[model samples]
Target: MSASIVCSALGFRWPDGDSVFTDLNLLIGEGRTGLIGVNGSGKSTLLRLLAGELTPASGSISITGELGYLPQTITLDATRRIDDVLGITAQRQALAAIESGRGTEADFGVVGEDWDVEERTRATLDRLGLGHLDLDRTVGAVSGGESVLLALAALLVRRPPVLLLDEPTNNLDLRARRLVHRAVADWPGVLVVVSHDRELLDLVDRIADLREGEVRYYGGNFSDYEAAVAAEQETAHRLVRAAEQDLRRQQREMIEARTKLDRRQRYGQKMSEQKREPKIVMGNRKRAAEVSAGKHRNMHLEKLAEAKDRVKEAEEAVRVDEEIRIRLPHTEVPPGREVLRLSTVELRNGPVLDLDLRGPERIALVGANGSGKTTLLRTIAGTLAPVSGEVALKVPMRWLPQRLDVLDDRLSTIDNVAAAAPDASAQSIRAQLAKFLLRGRKAEQQAGTLSGGERFRASLATLLLAEPAPQLFLLDEPTNNLDLASVAQLTQALTAYAGALVVSSHDIPFLRCLGITRWLHLDTDLTEVDPM
Candidate 1:
């Protein structure tokens, strides 16, 4: 029941003066905690602060035990041996010296009582399905998925009391992801993991949602968190409607009071002019009437103000995740139109492709990390050419690369969209950009500084808003680093897109949401499979 980590009045901001956290306070106890937020919501930054990788601008952090961190983007000396990654190089060297019968007292001290370090490391790696890999092999020789498992194995061997992992499941295949889930499930100490992988999040003890500059805890897995938010939003919307009606009623009552006062004033003026009473008596009556009218107007004014405040409070409680509802009749392909056809296309890895894609077909391209899925996407995007044969595209096509490098970093998002859409006016582009949640100065900010989710949104805007109105969309890992809400937004946007889609992703849920009509597994060849 004790808190393993605590933050009090924690404040931090980037060097560009962009504030991420202000007076943020949190208490993370011992549990499997899933840290989730939008791409640029400072989830990773908070982990860094807790790990002491970055210093906070203000406030303090308290920790009860040793802490370890696995960052979002791991930078490893790929050429180094696996032992070096596991922090056992010194111990292995000591053990070797002792075995050679030339060990000093210092060597014995280094080895200490932990003589089974090598065995434990091997067991951890094997449990993660990396048993086939040689312990002496360099990390550069392994696959990307293997490398992720290796990094996780590195952390597992440490057994730190407090572990912070940022996007640990990113770039991992299905098997590796399941291994990570098991690791999180079996973890005994305080573990906080930040990931977009829904399967991994399903293993957590509780969910901590970082939004609007604070953390809100939900007492279950990702599904529970989503259900809670849905219920809250429904209630908030109902309150907003009720508040709107109350405000209107208050305004109506205020106007009626003013009308009655006006009528009484006019009647009093006529009575005074007709001299219905003595001069002093009429004057006294007028004064009393003036005081009564003033009181009545003030009461109505206060009621109206109170009603307006209630409406504002109710509106503030509702989230503003606006959907992209732009209509693109120009991009819709005819039912009989031939979208793409590959004729005897020889791929890099000996896949002779003969495929035909008709109008508005949604295809999910599934493959392993090194199975040439990305290469195929680049070929379709015209960024790369196959070793032999031609990739024929009958309609205008646009590619959203896995890295999302389509945008110019130095340019603002508004400018980036304008670059892709030369024929559209700036005002028109801004209006469309607002649908992507980039409004006003946010649209004007340089693309280089946007959050991960914001960058994805900006890149998506550029592709969908291109001048030619792309009839074929080539999306690579489109939902990679997106938070759940942003992923929902992306799904809503793609639902409205009336074009053919070829998406490369391992996210089954997201692929299902796309309404994929065809499923193609790209190994040595691209072959269609049943959606089931």
Candidate 2:
């Protein structure tokens, strides 16, 4: 069997003097593999490199089979129909030819010899839970999740030997996610998936962890890999501590030896100054003591140097997890009983919905694609006026739009924070930003120049620095572009916040972790579920 992909000494660096990877080596065989790393650790960049969409700065990459890629972001034309978009026309032709029992040259060209393209298309679509999709429906009319499913369908038609997917289940619901898992398991070719979903990671045969421009492979599923990493980190920490103790002991010994040598030299000088009888004997005694002291001092110095080296080695080997410092001012305002109330709310061309939110309630809005979850949040935030409803908000609310529309590209992170938090003093605003891990000069950098994770941090700085921050937080897809570190930080901060939290996300595990007090599930209408 040939290798699916082989990358040796692969490396890449950006024009801004930032290195993504260096001297990286990887081998992908015919099996399900999971790629795990922090955001900006070059997961997507590596995928693109594998797909031949990007060139490696150095080294070599070889691929034996045809490769297909599904990027995290899919670009679909608004006017094209779903079937036309996925090349189903050829499939229809193949179907017609089979039913008529007629063989033509065009049929051979449309679909290669033995493969029944139409039957395959039907099977693939059905596996993706999209068999009922209207073939003529415009891409513009489809929801984000629908477009994602359609893109996968298009990829299925290629029937490539190697498949690379970036965040394949990002916008998928539970059912759709299960379908994707089934497809991946049934795939006969090589598969490399980059995702944060632990359930998906468990399905892979092995795990590759990207860190500090290198890939470390573990021959097991996610659970085994995670356990191994934890054990390694623990051992590293132990080594660091032991090395530190050894260095301290050596330093104390060296200090004592130096003190003894200095005292002996002083006594010898005093004896010479006396200039009494037996000058040769005094000189011999002084010289012998000096020699012994010198030898002892040299030995002590050598031990000290060795200890320092050991300490340095241990420090270099230790690694700590990254955390985001998202800090907001502590407010003492006594929140009212009713945070928000919606009565007789009806969306355009949709069903009637009513909601009552009490003090500091954490609510999760759930729905399929094209549902009015976003619309309801916007109406509550006073961005979009509802067609007909009685909406009430007791306190000031800050809305984090799905796309983070409030950020200014031209302004620096500090300047943007200053603009949103005008009432806050410069020192206070800077302090708040530091909590979000945008420290010192980074806060002064322009917002447009930051990475996706940094940009998210900058936005958080702006929102959290505001004086008397809106007690009611409305976030839509807050975890979309964040890295794993940032996601953890955000989760911790939200968990500790005392204000009312309302968010909409497709991340099932993250939502469950947030302890959503009330869940409102909407298809064409709204249905509330009790705590599970």
Candidate 3:
């Protein structure tokens, strides 16, 4: 296999004292590559650098094939039609062709080969399960998930030799995720994906772990990478323990030698004084003995330092602490038995849905995109007034909105938290925020500047620690931007929460884990089922 992309001895340091990598090297061949790392480990940074969106501070990155990158955030003009967006790229290329009109007769002869361009575009759309969508549909009317699928379809039409996708499955539903997986599996070129989805990683030929700004290659899928990491950590631990043992032994031996040497020196001086031997000879013998003892002490000291250094090095080789602490606290106040009561609630151009959530029941709002799940959530949370019926929330509700509109774009994280819970003292609020890993000066950073996952966590912290706390939670797409670990953490917290939970999520496994058996499917014809 030929090398498609290569990064040699790369190093980067951002202005915020964050290190991307130091002396990192990687080689990519013609196959699917998966990038896995903890949150904020520079996986996205590396992708940006490879896509020529960001320049590295040092070292070089070279791509052998035509590269096309699909960023985590897809951007499309809201007013533009799908056909216009798709054709814009082709039109630009055709314009370039027209500008450089020095083509041979062969080019003109084969110009008719473009006859099936429309057919090919349709096929691409169908492959993505979006053939039914009108090409003339305005992007503004499309949902977030559809926008992503459309972006992918447009990129595929370019037919570059290499595809670099960053978290392609993040917001996609199960069916859309399957479509992406199929596309990656069947793609005829090099593919590199940065995703936290283990299922998606399983389709890759190799996994590249990004940590501390360096890449460690492991052959095989996610399971293999995890196994290799475990084994390596074990080895590092063993080495550390052995080094500690050797250091202890050496210290004991050194102490004994020093005590014996002291005794010998004292005895020799006493004998010399008692026997009245030649003073010079006695002094010389004593000096030689002292020199030998000093040398021995120095050697032992060097050995001890070396042993300690080895242990430190071994400790740095692997991060053995991987457990998550989900410390969610609830107040003493309990909500009434009636959580939410909705009767004859009709959403615009959508279903008339009715829901009754009693006690601490976990109910999932299940529907396709644009099916008014979020609208229903807003209505129940008292944020949006319904057009037709009434929603009686017996107890005060806390809402994690679909877009987190409560979060201020201009305020710092700490200020945002303060704004939400004005009664809580600064010290207490900071302490609570620290539990979610936003500590020290990070609380002063702008909420808008944080990553999508971090912002979600901050919003969650605000609700969990509210003063007049809400017992009923209305979560909309809570798992949209969370990493897998964070998702698990949130799941554990929600499972432990002793209040009514009404969550709308695309994560099936997460919903199942929450014991949400009842679902209200919102479509033109409303349906409710117990899909336990």
Candidate 4:
């Protein structure tokens, strides 16, 4: 298929004057394209540019047809009806007026050719597994996943030839995610999605990796992309090794040349001391020898510089996947130790829950969106009071909410961690932060200035490194907006934590990676479920 979207010499910068993309060119053709990149690689920004939500500072964007965009964060007015959220309230009202025999020319014009708007809306909703939803229902009454589906349904109803989805599966449950995956798989026109969801990416026809302000396309899905990247990395490593060896060889040659030149100069000085030649002849020879030496030294220096440049270039091709290495010995919960208990707990606008967690049990909280997973976590963390119940914690606890709002944006990452571990010295905290991948000047950067991944690592460090170390950890949707590499790092970090973990998440693969001993599905009641 021909290119459906084209970006030529695109340039963009944040209001703070931090450049995101410069002279970037990209082409997206007809098919499902999964856009993958490390966090802060301008994936979301590029989507916004394509969707017309953001304008490039330079160059142009060309689209063959109308565009539909679903933003990462879906925010709708709580008071608005579903029809309003779908952008069809006016058309619905116009249809009602015509059916009531009070139709005006303007009302007819408002509806235009969409005489079957309600039918189309219902059909779209049904396709998204939202057939039960009434158009009159308020947006607040729906779950977060339903809200995302509603937004997608709206886009589907429009039938735009070009669709841009930014983390569409974020905060969505398994069932909801499958619905989205099906829709993406069935899309006929150009579809470009920026997502960290591997399953969603697997449904795409191709993968677009954005790195170092460049886009490289790979045929097939995410798995295919990974394989290709692995092969490329191996080659890059080999090149790096070869370049380093060349650099070392140049250094050794330069040293040998210098030594030989020194020996020749000493011999000439000895001959002159013995008065083997006339004074004028000796002076001319000395000047000639100095000029020759200078030429030889410059040549070696030039070769060394070239070798160093080659090494740098080769190393740049190798991908960086830094691991978070930290041990939480204090967070360990011994066997048979009671961690937490909830007795006859009734969550606000949610099902009653009863749970007795003991030892270092890792529990995976799985449930559909709006099933009160977040509410239960909050109640356990004592951030939200249950409508009626008793929550007992036998040990220190730390909660990492989905929003990751635990850190103070005004403070540096080091200071943020310091707030959590007040008794720990700054030097110690800085060292621990380095284990979380925040090293040196990075730990000193203000939290507000950090990227999404950096902010997450900082927040995680604060939680895990807190004083009076937490024995029970509650993480809610921790992998929602994380890049694939960040997810791996998080999994690695959690692997070292010996605390009892109660994590509520829709990411099945991530939960599996956590080695969860128990899987609980929250619905009308919490019940033990088979680990998928």
TM-score of each: 0.91, 0.89, 0.80, 0.88
Runs of candidate 1 exceeding 4 Å displacement: 1-3, 90-116, 335-337, 349-351, 408-431, 439-455, 530-532
- C-alpha displacement of 428 in model 2, angstroms? 2.9
- Which residue pairs in model 2 clash with each other? 325-435, 325-436
Query: Candidate 2 at residue 117, lDDT?
Result: 61
Candidate 1, 1-532: lDDT as tens digits? 4549899999999999999899899889988999998777889899999999889999999988888888887777789988889888889899999999989999999988889988998899889998887767777777777777788888888888899999888877656777888999999999999988887888898999888788899989988988999999999999999999999999999899999989988998999899888999888888998999999989999999999999999999898877767677777998868999887877776677777899999999887778878878777777778888778899999988878899999999999988898889999999999988899988999999997878888998999999899999998888887887788888987888899999888887789899999999887778888883
Give the top-scoring candidate (lDDT).
4
lDDT of 3 at 364: 81
Across residues 151-208, which tens digit of lDDT does each residue of candidate 3 receive?
Answer: 8887787678888999998878767888888888887788889987767888999998
Model 1 scores worst on lDDT over the 10 consecutive residues at: 346-355
Between candidates 2 and 3, the one scoring higher on lDDT is: 2
lDDT order of candidates, best first? Answer: 4, 1, 2, 3
- Tens-place lDDT digits, model 4, residues 1-532: 3449999999999999999999889998899999988998999999989988898999899999889999999988899999988889999999999999999999999999999999999998998999998898888777778889999999998888999999999878989998999999999999999988988898899999998899999999998999999999999999999999999999999999999999999999999999999999999999999999999999999999999999999999998888998889999999989999999999996688889999999999998877889999999999999999899999999999998999999999999988888999999998899899999999999999998999999999999999889999999999988999999999999999999999998888789999999999999999999997
lDDT: the better of candidates 1 and 3: 1
Ranking by TM-score: 1, 2, 4, 3
Q: On residues 266-337, what C-alpha lDDT tens digit does candidate 2 reach at each position?
A: 877887888764889887988799789878978988998899899888887776665654544452225447
| Cα lDDT listed for each candidate | 0.87, 0.80, 0.78, 0.93
Off by over 4 Å in 4: 1-3, 75-121, 134-140, 277-288, 387-389, 409-411, 445-449
